[model samples]
Target: MSVYDDYEMTIGIECHVQLATKTKLFSPADNDARDAEPNTKTHQIDFGLPGMLPVLNKHAVELAVRAGKALNSPIAHVSRFDRKHYFYPDLPKGYQTSQMYNPIILAGYVDAPLEDGSLKRVRIDHAHMEEDAGKLTHHDGYSLVDLNRAGTPLIEIVSEPDMHSAEEAKAYVSELHKLMVYAGVTYGNLYHGNMRFDVNISVAKKGATELGKRAEIKNLNSFRSVERAAEYEFKRQVDILERGEEVVQETRGWNDDKQITISQRSKEDAQDYRYMPDPDIPPVVLTDEVIAGIQSKVPMLPGEYREKWSALNLDKSVINSLLSNQDYAQITLEVQEKSGEASAKRVAHWFASALTASDNDTNDDSTQTMLYAARGS
Candidate 1:
């Protein structure tokens, strides 16, 4: 066996999900800031103008509570925001409003289904509500800052160091994305950066009790990128250890073209952030009744969706394809209910074939109705 054979990898993920709301978290600026002219969606609060105070968006709070229920995490009756001090062009304010002590969602577990049809439970540490920073684009001469996204609502889901393989990490992220979209948490828009992942990975000896130093791959925007980055980082760390050198704790960015990770900056510890409670915003007060109301709004989650799809007895590939698209999944379920199980299979096949033939978006009701008509014929 090679030197790498004696090691195992451990991975923890920090996932940021942008909440789908019309307005920003604290500011009234439009949350659909993507594609808009730079800095057009900004308000006084988003710009951190003098004498500005934040007003927590009630809709964002409700969505966060609903998200907690979807993740199988209990909602906290009281959760507050804290200031995470950092300086960057993207950050209009010197600090990012985040949660340090109390968070909205507590401990939970995600049952990630592997390719072998087996499940691995990835334990969640906590999920907290926060405001996203703005976007910075670097030009040859200078960097341009867009404050439109500065105050967008987000829930950062921090998972325990539970993943061992790249496949496991991919599965967990896939399941998490499905759950978030299915429960109306976010739009699940990858291109628009609706969700992004920060993967922290470290390797240890096969029987070693302690883990080696970890390097974090920051802001992985795609599921494929997350898996590929983990695989690359795992090998990189193993190679370093084999050379009798220690892996440095740092933040790295993935080079998609090179399929390698480049060092960005040294990783900062928690103390480096200088977390303090935001004086401008008060603690969110969630009562039992309020939480119950939010929980009631959560619809069918991915696990439940899988269970129902399994009963249809369709091909596994078809079932998976359907499950990933909420619109298609709902239409398939409705067709099954109306036409019976036998017709459901025929309709699904027709729908799948039509989609393959046309390469059209299945999110529209018209496309589904056309498939239904074709099935009837």
Candidate 2:
């Protein structure tokens, strides 16, 4: 007899995390590689050079598995890659390598805060490893494609349609972002396009087995967009239903400038993309020992860190700043290790002040940067 009596909103998310690797997923371009000129970073394999062999990036696999464990997803002993066939200027190979049938991480949950001071569990369906497509820059009259990102390693974490409200969906994304930040998955800087999310939303009557029509909002780079887009869609669809109109299933693009979701195409009109196994790459067979070892390598994560720090009732501002950046979390832990747990809060306060305040290459640079590095050292 709550809000459920009026409506039910089901939600799912697909979050793409770029691996912070020293090199590209398959090629040798530096991690977070950027090229000013189009197709400048191209390698034969990256350029879809004929008969080129792909050697799996060892670090990419390990980081994917490690992050999967942090998400509490079961490790798949064997995972395979698929060819998602599509044609776009940004796609150098005319296809993308991703996991479709089976993924690296199976099932998990991300706990999120609720409006009632309770917790809502965001169900994670799977987290799969894949390669990112290139970036397309559109000019006034033409478009150019940059291949530097063509082969970058990306881990796509998908969630079940378990969320019931826009707020819940936002918290879910924010929590996952935090977990990724702490685990070194990616920088989660939407402004820089380091991490991005796609939201799938559907609204239904309070009691209904059949779901209402759905719309997909693509590449929402910011957490605010994720929530606002969902809320906007919910209202738009609900209004349609109230007017006794049929809501068609379709994919849409977010017009960030207008703060609205615009239809790209009806779902049925979209291409199949003809998924098939990649003929070039071999199946990923992860042994049990390797899985366990990778799991062991992940230290206590954000949830655990939060629990341990709660006893001190630390300042919310300090906690917010610490959680804002994963690097700060790591620094806090290191400072605690060196200064002792009893004095951890005091050390963290000073560190947070410096990190949030100053810039590099100034008078306070050497000493503060050393204090920052000393925690890790």
Candidate 3:
């Protein structure tokens, strides 16, 4: 039997997404911290002032509901915020306001594509709303805190341990990222840390009923890192098992430079965080009319766009490029509407070429305007 026959890997991922809201989750401070100076976007509420109160952002909730719809998840009409106590320099409040017992989004699954051209449905355990902590930058011997991100809105999507391979893990995150971005829940920018993935991996004997000790790789910023880290851990754990060694249950960090996982600390359970219902913030009560309104505003997702563009018989790359970008997809639809169905193929080619020439600059309003003019011409 092959060495691989002796072991199987089980993987689950926790994805943290920064909501695309204009203000912080519980404060009126600006939420977009991309290029702003450190700590400049913070407010008194973000700093955990004694008298400051937590106010939920309505836009953030609407975006969360939109995301739930996109994920095929049921949205809870009544969701409450709790306080998760923790101590760190990045967290000024000592406790983060989050949803624990009742999350906004319920169980859902993402149909992720595999490398073998097959689909696997990854079940989502839950998606909970929370406030993000600050950023800590370490200098030579000191560290500085940036509270700009402290009160930012975040949704942590926890997945069931259904993925068995690195490809599945990558695909699951990729699909999740696409859905969140297309649904306008988040910008899904890895560079700005709009989304981060925490991968929990474990191994088992081919016919074992119970799973082996698992290690969580935290804060993986890219899909490639998730794949590589999973693969690396799989082999590492198998090797340990071969030597009659037990895998340690700990939290690890992905070393992109070394392409390996480094142990961070022993994993902590939920009780360690001291979760308690927050008395300051009231439970969010959503009426049927409000939920229906938000659902109505949900746009066509990437999967729908794919099905629509596939009928055009255009190249798969072209179809995917357009679907991956909202502006490109809008331009393609406009072209088909204004120039008739016959002009769609030529316009798709031109649009793909322009996208390539423009380096896929989605922020260029002028380029989009020109495309509209050309389609009308």
Which candidate tops lDDT? 1
lDDT tens digits, residue span 167-243, model 1: 99999998999899989999988878999999999999999989889999999998899999999999999999989
Q: What is the lDDT of residue 317 in candidate 2?
A: 64
Off by over 4 Å in 3: 337-342, 352-358, 362-370
**Ranked candidates (TM-score, high to low):** 1, 3, 2
Error of 1 at 263 (Å): 0.4
Backbone collision tally, model 2: 0
Q: Which of the predicted structures, 1 or 3, would earn the higher lDDT when compared with the native?
A: 1
Please give the distance, in angstroms, between residue 283's alpha carbon in candidate 1 and its true position after superposition.
Answer: 1.2
**What TM-score would each prediction reach against the true structure?**
0.95, 0.87, 0.93
Which pairs in model 3 have colliding backbones? Answer: none
> What's the true lDDT of residue 215 in model 3?
98
- Mark the regions of model 1 whose C-alpha exceeds 4 Å error after superposition: 356-368, 371-377
